[model samples]
Target: MTETLLPTATGGEARSAAWTALRRVRGHVALTLLVLTVGTVIGLVGPWLLGRIVDLVIDGRTDELLPVVLGLIGVAIGQAIGQTVGTAMVAHVGQTVIAGVREKAIRQVLRVSEGRIERAGSGDVMSRVSGDVETVNEAVSGVLPTLLDAALTIVLTAVTLAILDWRFALAGLAAVPFQVVATRWYLRNAVPVIRAERVAEGSRAQQLLDSINGANTVRALRLESDHLAKVTAASDKARQLSIRMAAVQRRFFGKLNYGEFVGLALILVVGFYLVRGDLVTIGAASAAALYFHRLFDQFNVVLGTFDTAQSATAAFARLIGVAEMATPDLRDGGETDSRSGRGTDGSVSLRDVRFSYGADQHTVIDGVDLDVQDGEHVAVVGTSGAGKTTLVKLVAGLLPPEQGQIVLGGHDLAAGASGSGHRCVLVSQEVHVFADTVLGNLRLSGEHTSETQARSALDAVGASGWLSTLPDGLDTVLGRGGHSLTPTQSQQLALARLVLADPPIAILDEATADAGSAGAKTLEAAAEKAIAGRTAFIVAHRLTQAARADRVILLEDGRIVESGTHDELVDANGSRYAQLWAAWSTHR
Candidate 1:
């Protein structure tokens, strides 16, 4: 299968996401800006007072010097207090915006179709959810306060310089040309560098996870060295990209440093000539120079964070790209008022159903028609590539039929994008064990399910044996760092979850295939109990499973070759079902 990634969002989309989030919390925006303004005003007072002392010292006014020096101390204290409060307020606002964007991104990820996710590789999807969100969060909470503060300081300081002498302000303008040129260059080049760095990091993480997860296989096949080499190559690539990204950032700073050199020299030159002409008082010239000098630090703060800011912007765009993914419906099954999917007879019908992989690929499921009444237990049996799994997926509303529609409980089963309009669960051989407590994982099916109810469900699914052996019973954690379970136990745990979820429709696609022969029988019995009252479909490779079904359908190359009760199919001596039974039974 080819892996196709979700493209990062365009600049317009990132800006739009920001604008939307800000609009929702305008109250926070107003309070934060007001506090920032007050803090910047306090910052302006320090430079002016320092200039006053310089002038006072020239005139030898020791009587007034003490008060002015004391006042400078007061300004320093006020600026410190204001800055502390301002940082807190701005950080609060930044977190709020991030929370909003993160919420939208998660919602859209939830809505994405299985097909889109398969096409976008598991690692890429995981990267968007975890890595991109983390990058945006660090940039926002960490960089937002300083960046905004520096920007405001630069703008206000220039205004103060103009108040003292416009030539000082014009002197500042001389630096703007260099700064503008540097800024354009940095933005033009830095974005791709940072974006590439992030992508490399995602790839590295994916390679590491794949290698570690398949360690046993790697060792068994003597491919440990090969896997290690792949991991090393991925890590090395990420490291190189990161270094290159830093080089670009350093070059930006180098250019900005040149602008600072030019601006400071021009300001001093302007001040010297202005003093000679006496267009401004000696005290005022000092004040303007002091103000311009203060700008150097603030300017650095803004420029130093430009790369981080660009990274944040790119990360935000990636997150919003996730939010932008639409949940495609298999068909037009409008919203159903009944999430329980009750009130109608629990029946399903597939008419002339056809499905294929890509446009040019041979059909995986040719045109077919079938129906099963509510509470009916039907078994679909076939060899590999017989379209049994595809049929179950269509019935469970996981895949859409290419040529026809599926009707469930008198409503079209569209598997509505958000998983609304129908209540169903599809259990396959692969079961995901979340990094949580056994109870916590089970509660994901129904949050309000009581502990007593959870225990009963576990017992019903024949997990009581291991459940009792667990250190904490249902409360025991069962993920990566927790107690491990065998494949059989894992399937049992899944069956228990199905009992807890208790959806109106339950589909099992080789759910017991992972178990050993003895474990398979146990799981099959447990599965029967779990899906007792629900409309169910089981795709089986085992003939015993088909023999026990209320009705059996034998599929060959994506078409139903035989359909009947177990005994009826067995009675037909030369039939396909009979041939399969003879072959399977002969093996036993």
Candidate 2:
């Protein structure tokens, strides 16, 4: 089994990702900042005006009171409007940034090598695409905006307090050392804890997904208890990590509360002294107290957002890590689609090809040389682990041979253009029926194929007859929650796609292995239509399929043990093919 790829990034990589995301929505950021600044300035007027009104009343100046009150009302309205606009702008920037990240992630996923994906299993990729992406989205949409607002409010409040009275400002900021120490400690401890939590969460999700997707296999094999144990272990680990994170937060917040208490106490004590000394008027002292009280709330918000900020930062790092994955250029010799057309004929040639799952593992395919003429239907019959599927994958360019070459027509399969239009198409036993309309699924084969072309392809595969019975015909939705197709019907749909693709070469890896006898006949007929003009490789599970082939190649332990026409092989008294034929006939 292949190692799972974790979604994570180092500090520098995370910073780079953040910068890239911010740069994409610079306009929104600029507008939001401008509006927030205006709002902050306007909001400060309320407290200042309150102080002025108090002074006016003390001095018995009734004439100025009416205008000040009206001015305060106007400032309140402006602040409200500015806040609303700023919030909207912030949300727009957040959404845009996340959208860009999601797009990049998807593109990277598509570019990843199919062999790598198969080895690593679907669980890891699914976790990254669904779970990790969602975590990042929540960070952007919920935590990011709150952190920005809180930070801005703290800075503005600090400035206003200092301008009002230097002594009061000093007193209000007296608890800075405690806050700095606590925050530093929290950040230092919280980062690793949250990182662990994220990894645990991903593992838990992957395990659960695996259990659900392989439920049928688990039940058939009576491995339900084993799967349940694995899922429970993963879930428990995630729960523990979350609890640890919460405990760290509780400790950090306790210190913050203590700091708040100390700061407020110092401000009141200093304000009383300043007023008695006549260094500032009573109204100034009152406003200083109000500012300190308000600043405490804002400061609390700023500090409180740290927990969410840490989680968001970690999630964002994973998103960036995925987006930054290198997409390998698979084209050989720097060839482009324009430089090479489809192979002139579907003839396939393999020369001393070799491959193994790992460096230390025994070779699965070793120096196997074979050739199939254009429009020839060759059947490869072998028991499990004979490297039949592996050989087919090599021919389709889904995996590169470790040694020698495989060519289709005159183009080198290993070095030819990597585009879908230039390669052989493989249809495996487990054909995927996507959750889409029949037409939509057909169009996936060749995006430019028209509806008429799609219908023609379906008709060619003998699927059109059954398809016409669907309530919506080509428009009928299929796969999970939509219309369910039997194994034979799904195989027919896959063959329809193959027709639309129109590749010069095709490989069928036991494509009808899951079908019943009746269904198999229907599917075989469709398969015949699909392979009509193509050079086809059939990894035959049934001897009947081999009988229909132009020639039969019998594989044993990754070597071609026998090769001849079906009758010739059968007549060869002691050949492995003859023995297998005898057994198959007995079973039938």
Candidate 3:
């Protein structure tokens, strides 16, 4: 069990995340608010003019109709202009906020621990990157504007309605409590359902992506129907959850509509009785009626705005969850030797090392001690279920032992300097051919390598032959789901990179397994040449590579069963290495 920690960045809670995101475009936000205020003023003017027109008509001021009508038209035109500017301003602000969010999310992804990324799965990351972030775009843009407008409209309309007739205004607001209660009921039931729908949707997308990436395996095993069944079940669950969400929203809005109708009827009845009693003039009644519609219209907008806010809150929560991921303990400024160090001494040591997958898990490398001196090549052979890979990972700095320490060239690999040992390279049978050029891949070790250095590195690994045959030579693109190199050729290319990386210490964990005996022999010879005068540890698969080691280590369970030269181990008649060699000889 290799003790792995997640990659994360320095961060606080989701609340902090929202604040951090907002601070990115505070200036733009201020501008947007200013524009929205102007728009609100313009929007209110149109209704005010209508009310004034009614007042004029009722007062028998027929002479004032044309000017009043013209004034109303001018207000309408100004409202339209203001609305356009406000919308554009808000949109620009939203885009800037969205851009900031996208950049931050990507930065977070990069800062998170490598171990966490592996555990989280690619699908979740993809969902966050594409789907989850998309939800926030609408939240950032439309929700804020609508909420502002709703708040202002509610305030202005309530004031105007009260001026018309306090009795009628109070009557108009009577249905608000009913709408509020209904909305609360809907939200209480709907929030869980909406959240469930989002989770199910994410899971379905993840599983579908997994299936697509492994389509060859599914088809080979004739499990297409089984895969489809699993996906269909997830999709059905998502659909059911969505249906529940839709049902709740419909019921919530339906109740809102009912409240609107009830409120309007009350207004009409109350206005008519007030008119009969001569308590309010006809013009005030007509103006009040118009004001009633405006009040309710803005009330609906306010309610809808709240609904959007709820949805945005959920999305913000998810984004904040991502932002809250722990940061890695990378080396601080002035704490690390420059990455430019050209260390050539490969003395590697692990003292009293211990590691476990979890707190409750059994220790894999229990108090293990290992050392490889400069120019010494060692082979660690282990039976199945033994902690071979775990031990190798500890030595390679891919994982830190729970207890004890690893030292390369007397430098302790601490939290900040954990991957500082990247100068100590590890090549495993599981090769990752990145979507890049051959030269690009090699240059990952040292980005400033010249073409001469790259060509020399390729030639040293016997990969120069196939590499030269490529259409673009070292510039040929590879591993983009289109271009490909054979497993053997890819393994050779990996070795070529190791040659270029030129680490003082190298850990080869079955690096040539994909290449078979002949190809392994070629790679083994190349590795010997490249690793000369540097400390190396080979987790050998083929007996030939082990036979070439300066020493061989036999491990069983979590203990070193034997340690001696390969020739010495072979001569020990019934030794594990002797038996392993015999088996390999027979297979060959």
Using lDDT as the measure, which candidate wins? 2
Two-way lDDT contest, 1 vs 2, winner: 2
TM-score for each of the candidates: 0.86, 0.85, 0.74
Worst 10 residues of 2 by lDDT: 331-340
Tens digits of per-residue lDDT for model 1, 125-182: 7877788888777876778888888888999998999888888999988888888899
Candidate 3, residues 1-588: lDDT per residue as tens digits? 012222222234555766766688788778877776776776666665676777777788989889878977887887677767777777677667667666767667765644355556666667666776777678666776667666766777777778768888788888788788887887788777766665676678777887899999999999999999989998899899877777777777778888888888888888899889999766667777777788788777777666556656665565556655544443322232233354755777878888777678887878778887877998988877678877887776666668998777766765545444444678889888889888888887678988888898888877788877899988888997536988778877788788777777788898877876677778787777767766888888776888889999987767788889988999997898899888889988
Q: Which segments of model 1 are wrong by more than 4 Å?
A: 1-3, 200-244, 277-279, 328-345, 351-363, 400-404, 410-421, 452-456, 459-476, 481-489, 516-522, 586-588
Q: Better model by lDDT, 1 or 3? A: 1
Ranking by TM-score: 1, 2, 3
lDDT computed for candidate 2: 0.81
Relative to the true structure, candidate 3 reaches a TM of: 0.74
Query: With candidate 3 superimposed using the best TM-score fit, by how many Å does residue 376's alpha carbon deviate from the native?
Result: 5.9
Candidate 3 displacement at residue 494 in angstroms: 5.0
Index of the highest-TM-score prediction: 1
lDDT of 2 at 85: 78
Which regions of candidate 3 are displaced past 4 Å? Answer: 1-12, 52-126, 141-176, 202-233, 262-295, 298-302, 305-312, 332-367, 372-378, 383-385, 394-428, 431-507, 516-537, 542-551, 564-573, 582-588
